[model samples]
Target: MTDEAALNALREAARLSPENLPLRRHLADQLLASGNLSQAETEYQAALGLSPGDHGIAIGLAEALVRQGKNEAALTALDPLLAMPEHPVRAGVLAAQAMLPVNRMAAAHWYRYSVARDPSQADPELAHRLGIGQPSAPPPSSTSPSPIPSGPAGLPAQPPSPAPAAPTQQPSPAPAQQPSLIPTAHSPSVVPAPHAQPQAAGGPYGSADVEPTAEVEHSPVTFADVAGMDTVKEALRMKLLLPTQQPELFAAYGKRAGGGVLLYGPPGAGKTHLARAAAGELGAAFVNVGLADILDMWTGSSERNLRATFAMARRNRPCVLFFDEVDALAARRSDMRQAHSRQIVNQFLAELDGVDEHANEGVLVLAATNAPWYIDAAFRRPGRFDQMVFVPPPDTVARAAMLSLMCRDKPQAKMDFDKVARATEGFVGADLKGLVDRAVEAKLHESIRAGRPIPLATGDLMTAAKTMRPTAVREWLGTARNYVLHANESGAWDELLPWLRDLR
Candidate 1:
């Protein structure tokens, strides 16, 4: 493709996904390479907004300013990055080079400093112009009569050329270096281009090709997309949704922005769907994790993976980290027969507690489990899994809603939703969907038989519901009942108690 075409394509992509830091940075790099200094500066500034602490992008912006002959502006742009310890040699080199056109003396100081940090990258050609040689020990005191070597002509050999017209303002040296703990900044709204999830030998989730970056997976589902379960919806609105929308009100009473909300119920009860809806409603990024994302076959790796996942989650602040079947990972330590399993539980607690260096500061952790009884009791402490919301089978209202939604596009007559909903009591969202499919199948067969069309009616749906066997809720409730009775401490199972009593 032509350069113009590539530039246009990148610009369009950056426009479409304005929060995409990597895409914007890549576009900025391309523009700078093409000598489009002004546009490159704008793109770099944008990328910097998305990732304020990114030194590489900061240096890139400085370079663009330097290319435009704004040496003083370049120095200001490079200030924050230069202040960072393990001082980036690239930033220093760029700072030195950006100053070369006007402030040769200041440029010489930075040049010497850059070469001290990275001998390989210092531009030899530029160093030659400043009357400097390769990096060596400290030079003699400035009081010496002859600071630099003189040629046979009694003058410095190859006298440095004068810089172009200097701007009114003088350039200052790079800022003093300070320590920075900036991690890789990846915008949670941006889905990285498809690539392998490379792993390393010693590090947790690492490889030469991969840097420790944030993980953000998007979900299109919102509360409107969720089929039914108004009870569950209102519970979420009160627990997760309201606080996020009005954080200041909650903070007035010492409440933090995000916390853990446990969604537990029978299998296929739309627990995962509820989590996705919460993410969508918040307009926050979503990351759905499973055993495959954390568990490793090797020893001591599981805990590291847990730490790494939490770290990644925190980086994608305001992120919803949904864990399906979380009981398998956070199972009661007393019940765990193996030491490794127990250790993993401890690691989870540490992450939840914001131990040592890591914390779930802005991350909203949502874990769903069929066996909430299996999760370690420690996980239910104040800050972690504080609110447990039971996602029961679809009620009459939910059943009717699910049926109407499923059949909205199909040829359905004025249907008696109440009749079908009453018939399919104890059914979950998945089961309700199956009933609709069965009804559609019947309509399809009748159409084929008569060689004409037949719209779905209430009789068609009720017949399909009757044909279906006992709902899966029966199987799940049988197991859950035993827990609510035997382990009723802390009233964690109090909500389940009422439901169990109703079933009886």
Candidate 2:
């Protein structure tokens, strides 16, 4: 039989036997193959009603809705699946859910969970696509686990008594320490001893202690992939690249100079992307240490983590240490707050000021935060962030560039670039990309329903623009602008004040 005949047979069987969930599922598969996503979604939902525990049906239905440009609907469909108890791929479902909302923290948790559950899934590609990182190596296998040291005599470990099984599993035993294969400039003998002070009790500042074993994997991003932000790119090249390329000139300034750069702006303005691009351009190792990465559940781990992060950055010279959300980590602390938060903030302040002035260690620190005002005053002083740049919302020229890049491969009908740019006055880079994605999805869905080629018309784009409002609010922009104005008038930041005026 032809492919169409087989699909027709499946549909007829499903219609004749509505009670058979397998038949319904098969019908849904056939519909999907024929690009009839609406019908496929209906059939998948029917199958789900019959077999509520079927994760396959749930995923299929959610994906169908996603293809139909209904991401919210897809998220709703997955909510019940996420609440299920003890599924092997539950982590995968949770990750998908986080992606729908673009919640990076939640997504990172789910990605980690997914990898922990199935060690074989610890590939870097998925994490890179999600704008996170995966560990370079797969976690040790449970069947043939690595042996942990018991004592000085290397005693064999004892097995624990069995208990009632639970759905959520505890982490595996810590892997044994391996010998270092690479040589380092600093000798291990000269390294400072781990402090023996008693850690403070956990309080409102959360755990101040960060575990030495805790490490986050970040997928490296290259400069070629970043879409726009030419001005920001050029500024980073001048500030970071020029010094390294010409070290003799850099040395002339001596030890008292060379500080970090701060990129402050509204969220989704590509600050993180710019940091990654600079790292890639300069051939430097990219280390992303965010506030969430450092916050530990123990009393002194956060501070220790901060120290470890800086040490690692220094050791791995020609590196870029990116703090994506600095305000959360270095917030101005009130005297009444618990001691832990204040300690972490102070540790950050010290690290920011401790970069070697004359060594030209080739360590470039790039910190980004939407709420710059919330950061502690010490971190913003001249010696810490020598240069601060404001990354504003894209203007018409940049918006057009972003749209063109987003629609590069899509089959588009005649589009009015001017109208689209004008319509997206306050939209950030990410917002414009989302608009393009929505329009492409709508066009694909329509084409599938009509059994035609995927071709996006101007109307489809216009409809997408109407549905996606500017994510940034006018009130928020006004507040930020006012803060910039106040700072400029105060003359507190001589270098950044001029840029602030121009931005406004």
4-61, model 1: which lDDT tens digit per residue? 8999999999999999888999999999999899999999999989988888898899
Q: Write the per-residue lDDT of candidate 2 for residues 348-368, one digit (tens) a residue.
A: 888876745543356787899
* Candidate 2 ranges beyond 4 A from true positions: 1-228, 253-258, 355-360, 413-416, 481-489, 492-504
lDDT of 1: 0.71
**Stretch of 10 with least lDDT, candidate 1:** 180-189
TM-score of each: 0.57, 0.54
Per-residue lDDT for 330 in model 2?
75
